[model samples]
Target: MPAVDPRLLRYAKATRVFLALSVLIGAGQAVAILAQAWLLATIITDAFLHGAGLDDLSGQLALLAIALAGRALLAWVAEVIAHHASAAVKSELRMRLLHQVVRLGPRWLTGERSGELTTLATRGIDALDDYFARYLPQLVLVCFVPLIVAGRMFAADWLSATIVLVTLPLIPLFMILVGLTTKQLMARQWASLQLLAHHFLDVLSGLGTLKSFGRSRVQVATVEKLAAKQRKATLASLRIAFLSSLVLELLATLSVALVAVSVGLRLVDGRLDLQTALLVLILAPEAYLPLRLLGAHYHASAEGLGAAEQVFTVLDREIPATGTALLKANRTIELEHVMVASPDRDSPALDGLCLTIPPGRVTGVVGPSGSGKSTLLAVLLGFTRPDAGQVVVDGIDLATADLDDWRSQIAWLGQDPMLFAGTVFENIRLGRPAAAEFAVRRAAGAARVDVPLEQVIGERGNGLSAGQRRRVALARALLLDAPLLLLDEPTEGVDPDTEGELLNTLPAAFAGRTVVLVTHRPALLGLCDQVVELAPAAVAV
Candidate 1:
């Protein structure tokens, strides 16, 4: 990646504004640095060489104090801007990234790791703190202060300026060489972190299954191995950072010492005056300071740079086309020759399938594992688009219909429903947030949700049993009351008694909605007005 990506400016408006302010601040800081150096040099020369007393140097002393104060104030102001800019830029990038992900939809997200994306939005974006707070500000100064300091030095004394100009490039030249290696190390460390996050999340999500299979210990060992690899990569990056810092410091110190020696010799030989010599010596180090600081902070900012590249990759995905047509009520859903492919599967999920369901009726979809039952619902829900053929609703092509408007007509309940940490009422109200208490209670009663409304539940409904959670989710779906209801294996993982009770309630709860049910139970199929069985993706349906 380039030291600064132009996409950052394009994707985040705050970055553009920050850069503009940085330029103005940088110019002011450059002027302040020169004034302070010149005033300090004049004060020292006047006092030492001309035997100037306090009264004679009072005005110069006051001017020097003001210059020093201005430089410090500018530094503080730059710091404040850097922090604020860092926060604003990070927030902007994260929001853009999340919005882009949503635009790409669940189809695109299926291929990505949730943990990795979570890390990118949180820790990955956070890494930019060093980039904005320290590295970027110094980068602006490197553009302005160094050149200004060197120009003043050249006008005062050409020989000392020549030494500074010749040695200045050495610091950056070495920094570039070290940075190449550091970049590779940082990439490895970042990759390791992402892998660790992905694996850790997987372990947590499947911990119960691992324990049931007596393989939890195996997963623990695997996690330990990944953690160790991440640790090693991090240590390697730190080692390179420390080594580069040392190299930069040594080059800068030697360059400044060379200028000091040259200036001292010329002053002793009467080739240079005390004021000019003092100015040259003081300003020599100033020329090297920005470059050295930049090299040091580059390592600190590398992790954030790597993360930004990944975020941009996600942001660059092509969003599926949508349309402006509003979906009307009493519309029929028709799928003609639909085929959906999966990257990880050999065959398509839905292949050359044609189907239709009339408005306000329950349709049951039954199939074996790996068949297109769930894929059919995904097609109707607009989460997965067909590679060939079209899904039409009331003569409007779903591909051409506005997805938000289309989805507004849908109430979906997945086999594994997600529940946040909240009370029963809050979880049920998610389907229809504006629903009154009586309406909520009616839906819960229809769905057979016996839990108390004020009873608190853990995240993912951890406090409830599988059957209770499904009932809560069903209540949510019932509360939605959208025109279309899509339920995928709602009775899955429930006991036989609970499953029969749920089946008894579903038909009445599904009344007055265009319902598509994906399931394997014969009892549930009996409740549907029409039943369709899908074959494996290898064969046409």
Candidate 2:
């Protein structure tokens, strides 16, 4: 794939007005610089050699001053325009990427690392700044400025202009040679970053487990090793970038030196005028300036390109549109020859096992750890699409259904509920943002979550006990007013007394609705209407 993604056209479309203005302003600056160089050179040659008057000198100086001021003003305006355009492009692309991921569904995102996704959304999208702000404008200037400068140079002295043209290819040639290494280095650097992200996120997610087992020191050693590898990869990338910059700069400088030497020889030989010699020297640097800057930024942008590739991989993944009939709220579920595989493993989590969830019944799913309990729940929740067979809900296939609508009809309470860092009011209201205060209170009461709604949930609900978090999650789901509820390990941490009270209170709230509760607790199972056992993979296989 090319470094510049064609998909970036979405961002390019975001601020067309500002982009146009930025280009115009940038070109204006080039024009100003060129004119000032021309005027000052002509004025110097006239006053020193041609014996021009002081008034003529004053007039030329005034013109030069105006050009300089205009260049400064245009440069400032260009910066303003470029900054806003870059910001708009970044914001639009971030939102677009997020929307793309969400629409593509869990099949694409579920198995991916959160930290890598964070890096992609932040630093990866930022690479477009180079593509749009630096590379693009320079690309434009590369066309206009160099051509204009070369034409002016040729007009002054075709001999020196030809010298510049001949040596110009050398810069990109060496840059290409250096850039070959750049691509390889960037690939390695990105891999290292992804590895670090994977490790870091895994560690953070399991930090509590590590502490409980007193193995945090072991994990710390592992993290240090990973960080060391990342540092080495980073240095390797920077070494290539610096080398690329050096090679490009050296080539451009050599070309300018050659042009200067030719112009000097011509002037000393009495075949060229002083003004023409000066113009040739000045315009020579202008011709190679854009090319030099492009080389430098290209290296910086390659890392971003690597990250974008990963993001594109997610967006491009095939999420089948099965055209299966939508499963809406009758609460009846039938699993026929259902099989779901672990994304990071070879074996199926739920093998070709059939089961039925009776409509509007409080059914319990019980199994040992790694015995396909949670996987079955994920499949029910539409997070893990089964590799084989049908998950039929209310006589409709889960695949073809309008997922958002199907999921909206469900109230879910998972083993570890996701609680954003905010007041409990916000977390509970997540089920329905427009839910009234009294409605929220009613749901909270039904879940037996005694915590005040005004209390803030710390990061990951660290402020609450395990049972409290589960209760809050149950409250949130209840606030949805959905007809069917899925609860995973709902009463695992609650005391037997609280668990009994919850089981008794919970069924009343469901009235005519259905509930599927998962738990290993005898206390919770006793209260359920039905109990289903999931055999181990060994037995199913």
Candidate 3:
């Protein structure tokens, strides 16, 4: 929002090079502006004062044409460069922000609004087109153009140059004041817009539930209310933007008028020649053009700047620490006084609890709802960090072990197994991308995925039955053959026959592997080498 934000350069180094190129182009453009003004003035004075014919001024007119064409070409080039730089910066920022979010994991994101984040990554970032394509290029021009034009004016007419210099500061002075107000308004408008987007997405995702409960009309009213608030905030922000542009236009116009009056008066008294007076009049407007355009485009880009500020806030958050040590072959895991606090709850999810899972055996973790069952799994998977203790693997602190390395050794199946949009074979191969076709078919058979291996599944397994989707996820986990297997409610949605078949395969599938099984199903407990029961919070206390 200032002439330039430092974060822009910090996030996009290519922008610095782009700005440098813009400076060079702006300097060339300034020279073209000065030359075009001088040539036009020279030709006009020849025709009007000296009664020269068209032929007498032909050479100067030709030079004037070249200057005009050159200026237009330079302007076009500047725009193209700005667009390229903008695209590169937006891509880099989006990718980096996504990586940061993934590193932070679900525990940190539990309290965040998904729709708001999606809007920020998509529409919010797209708004920055104006900032890079229009405002940034003009910002460079403002620094170079005015000084170049004013310097030429001094050599031609010192008094006119003095007047120009005295009035130039007024444009930026008024711009800063209006820009401060506009920045606040733009930020508010963007925040309201994000809320509206979030509400709209939420309604769409839950439209089925709303209709079933006969609350669809009620939700429509809620959406309308949010839409109205967004509309009001947007209009208010636009009013300020228009008002600021009007003020800047008036100030620049008045400054040029003052310069014209002084030049005309000097010409009338025979103190200045027609050529010098015309040059001053022509160059005066050019001197103030960059600053005026900069102010106008600044308002247009305010929303993007505000969105960028929010992106920086997300990127600045702390992520769970990862280490470089490789997980060894012995897969015994120990939790030492582990404590994990829930985001919305008053007490810790897992409070000062300790457990040991021996190597090469299946362990069952049974607990009531909200008794830290899922939280314990999250900690084991390195998705959440313990507040007061550590997790050790083969006597090595997992906190100091490489997360990717440790996770590569694990195959996880959650209560609601996530199945993506892909062919059955493709989804299963996601666990190990280089898996053989034979291996995929074998894993699918083991999980009782009856569909053809090439059958396509819609987004979030929409086209498949709930039981089929769970089997696909199971096949994915089985295909990986990871040293550590973790299953949470593995047979939750399947039929009894399919569940029995899966239970039968578990023993062979988990043979000689360390496994942590979390389930309420008694059938699953029969296959565990050791069953650990987690008591309620009050009982644990």
Candidate 4:
């Protein structure tokens, strides 16, 4: 990320407003700094050298109080704005990221980890609080304060001003050098955190299976290793940050001391007035303070900058163009030399394959394990786009159709169906939320779901067996009563009796629909009007 990524300003309107406000606040703070310093110098010099009474210095002291109050007020306002701006920007980025993920579709997601993405959207984005609340305000001050302070010092004493100018650049120069190392360390720390999140989520998801296989301890050890790696990376980053902060502080302290020495020597020799020397001494440290603070806060924000970079990487991915035309009715579906590439495989999943399915008929697709059976269903269901050729409905190309409108006519059941935590009726009603109770029960009956409608299930339907979960998913799909239905191994992982029961329900369940069933069972193929077989290397009849 650059000092200020243009994408942040472009994506989050709140960032632009925050920056503009920060500039105003920085200018106010600069004025307050100069006022406070000048008032203190006048009060001290008048009281000590002129033998001024408390009454004579009272007015300067009062104005000095106002300047002090003004500076504090501005700081508070900046802090408040920084927090609000941080929240708004985070919300905007998360929403855009989610929408972009949806636009990229399931095919793009197939190559990525859900846990990594979860971490990015949640904890990763939250890290930006440091970027806004600490780093950005300091950055704004670095721009405004140093120049104003330097100019004030130059007016008071040119020799001291010259010294300040000569030494000020060194702070940022060394800061840049240290920042390079910090950036690398931060990147490593962030990568380790993401890896830990990914594997931890994977372990949790497969915990039950691991226990069944007596390998849960292996997964626990792996998670511990990942967690330890993340911890070490974090400590390493913090160590570098502390070392860099000390370096900045050392440079800033030395520069301030040098200015103090010059001002004191000039004062002793009567070359500089008491008031002028006091002002010069006071303003010297102010000139270097912002830059030193900037270096310190950069470490606090480095993780956020890294996360923003990843967010941009995902947002930059290209999605296929789509159209707005809606399908009117079930029509013959055609795949014209369709080709779909696989990121994990060198060969295309569906290579220049073409097929046609008559409307309102059950078509079975069978293939070997590595064949594109599921890929074919993904393409037909619009979750994956073909790299070559067209999927046409009647005469309209699917690529040109409004995907949402097109999907409105589709009722699909994947091999592994996801069921949210809810009553059985609620899950079935998900297909058509406005459907009446009778319609919901009818669909559930059609799919042979024996679970009580009022019975509640756990996440991913944990309360139900595999066969019951499939039936519930099938019921949800059936409830849609859509013109087209796509099922991938709907009878998979079931006993023979359960599979036969499911197969028996298919003909009536599939009635008056353009159905594409991907299964290896001969019994399922028997129910199809026409069967299409796909080879490992090609599509065949």
Candidate 5:
């Protein structure tokens, strides 16, 4: 619901460049074609009709060859420019989409599915390739090439040009009419893909749970049903695309035949000169050729347009308020009547609750389930906003500073510590890319993640034990060396031994940093310098 960002209009640049190249190539192609007809007419009317023989024919053949080669070379050049330009545009678009997502931050992604997001980022953006490569490029040819060819036709003989122009609009007009149906089909196809992506990610994430409950077969059957629906939608879209192409081709073919017929009649009637009639007949098809190509590719581009519309929706979302002021010092964080609400605002979670924890101290937030312990940390990290009052640091309102700059002053371990598909070293190093090897090893030692750094974490850290994943996540936070550290239940799923070690090494691991931790565990509560409970909102969630 935010105002559309002007930055997204950058997609237009790629389209413009594509169209420009198309005009150049299309004109070059039209010239070669017109020359071919003129040369043929000269050979037929002058040489063949007169006493000229083999020698003259040989000279004309060489001229024709030169024209043919020129057209071929220009066509090849056009293709290269199109492909390279398309690739650059595709790369830039993907990077922009990713940057937009990151700027929007975790608040948006948490409610969305991973597979659907992946599909949007990967398959969705890929659809735009043909929009740039084929449709826009050929559309340029359709418009400009025809104009050039038609002008040459009128100069040669206005009657022939009139016949061709009368039928020319038939192709594009029919294409547009059929395109309405194709657009609807493409929309259905996109919806099917989104549903398929959501279903697959849900199934994969819950596979362990499904297997434990002996419900894997049910999920498999559900997937089969979804896949069948997707297949149906895909076929429907393709069928429409093919049918539309057929209609456009038919219209173009009819137009070309009409021009050929008129030229032939004029030649037979002796009303038109022989050479001019031959030229008109030959050049007529060239005028409509690019239109045919554009019509077909327009169907291909429809899917991309639909996908882009969906992507634009994300970019258009109002980036809800986040902190702007930098934390003045490392010693303290304060919240005054900070209330965290759902995006829907149907149920507010944390009420007008207030809290303060000093620097160099460990704090614990404990609450019954549905209490806003997690939301408190979220607001502090600027992932969510307080509905009523302000969250402040050293008298600077969190809402007044640049959010990303404010967040950099703190290292946070969320309830779910994200681990990519890489080695443990890379995962921990993600927090502090410039940290030296020795510094990294020491942090790992403090967090007790002593496993070999080269070991793979598997998909989502499945290769490691729960305690090991916890320790590795802790190592990432420690390696950051941030001024303020926020730990959201560092030991919730960890074992007692790992928990005891984390507790024992707590002071040294987090020495001199302001630490605010969220925990329901009694053992973790004892380690904090203070404990605060975020009371539930007046109305239950």
Candidate 6:
């Protein structure tokens, strides 16, 4: 990532506002710092050199106290502003990133891993807290504070000011050199960390499979190795950051020393007054303080900067254009020469595939495995766009119809039912948020979900048997009462008895609704009003 990414400003409006406020606060802080330094110097010179009694210096002491309190207050305000800005930016970025990921659709996401994406949206983005909270505010102060202090020094002692001016460039120059080196290291560390997280999530998801195969113990070693590698990468990145801080601190210290020597020599030779020399010495370190802190905090934020680069890359990807037209009430759907190619396949998943799903009827789509049955349903659901084809619903081109509106008319049940961590009633209610309790119970009964509606289930329906979970999903679908119903292997994982019950209930449950059922089961096909068969390569309408 560049030292400053424009995407941060482009994507996060809150960050932009925070930055603007930070600049204002930085200006006030700069003024407070100057006042604090001047008063402290004045108090020291009057008490020590002029032999001013405590009574005589009371006013100066009070003014110095006020300046000190104001500077501390401004620091606190800057910290608070940075913290809120970080939180707001993180929230905004996560929301936008999630929305964009959904907009990209599953077709695009199929080539990506869920674990990696999860880490990116969660822990990866969280790393940016330091970037906004500490580094960014210091960056603003680095710009303003040094200039303010240096200007005051020039008025007090020109030779000391010149020395400070000539040496200040070295700090930033070395900082840039160190930053260039650590940038690559930090990127590697972040990549390793992501891989480690992905590996852990993958292992957790497949633990059942590994245990079934008696290889669970073997994976433990692999996980440990990956973890060790991640730790090493983290340490290496930190080492580089520490080295960079050391270099900045050394440069700043040497620069201050040179300024101190110049001020001391001038005061001894009567070229500068005691008060002016004391002020110059005091403000010299203040001029370099912000720059030094900026360098140190920059390293602290390097990981976040790297993650931000990947986030920007994702955000920059182009999504297929969506339409604004609405689906007609009739809901008759047609596919004309639809071709959807999978990323890894040479041939299209659905090539020259034409089909019609008339309103108020049931249509069964049957095909061999990988015959684009699911792909056809995906096109209808607006989850995947055809590369070469048109989809029309009631004479309105689906390509020109609002996808959300079209989807709103659909109640979809995939091969695998998805269940959240909630009561059975709550899960079913997800189909229609405002549905009445009587309606939910009726739908559950129709789907053969005989359990009490209040029974709670674990994530992914852990407490429910495979057949029960499928019925729960079916109950949810039945509750929706959408104009269109799309079921992909709805009876999968259920026993023959349960399948028979579902087949018996499905016709009445889906009465008067347009349905596109994707199934290979002959029993399911027997219930459809019409059956469409697809071949591996293509199917003619």
Find the candidate with the highest TM-score and give its number: 6
Best by lDDT: 4
lDDT of candidate 1 over 277-386, digit per residue (tens): 98888899889999999998999999999999898888877787788888764588889999888666778898889999999998899889889887787788788889
Say which prediction, candidate 1 or candidate 2, comes out ahead on lDDT. Answer: 1
Worst 10 residues of 1 by lDDT: 532-541
Residue-wise C-alpha lDDT for candidate 2, range 334-434, written one tens digit per residue: 99999987655567788886888888778888888777887787788777788899888877788878777777788888776888899888898997999
**Per-residue lDDT over 300-363 for candidate 5, one digit per residue giving the tens place of the 0 to 100 score:** 7777778777787776678876544555438567888876776655567787778887878887
TM value for model 3: 0.93
List TM-score per model, in order: 0.95, 0.86, 0.93, 0.93, 0.92, 0.96
Model 4 stretches astray by more than 4 angstroms = 344-347, 431-435, 499-508, 538-541
Better of 1 and 6 by TM-score: 6
Q: Each candidate: what lDDT? A: 0.87, 0.79, 0.87, 0.90, 0.80, 0.86
What shift in Å separates residue 536 of candidate 2 from its native position after superposition? Answer: 4.2
lDDT of 4 by residue, 54-131 (tens): 899889889999999999999999999999999999999999999999888777887899889999999999999999
Ranking by lDDT: 4, 1, 3, 6, 5, 2
RMSD (Cα, Å) of model 1? 2.1
Instruction: Flag the better candidate by lDDT, 3 or 5.
Output: 3
Cα deviation in Å at residue 514, candidate 2?
3.0
Quote the lDDT for 524 in model 6.
Answer: 86
User: Candidate 6: lDDT over CA atoms?
Assistant: 0.86
Candidate with the larger lDDT of 1 and 6 = 1
Output the lDDT of residue 175, model 2: 73
TM-score preference between candidates 3 and 6, better one: 6
TM-score of 1: 0.95
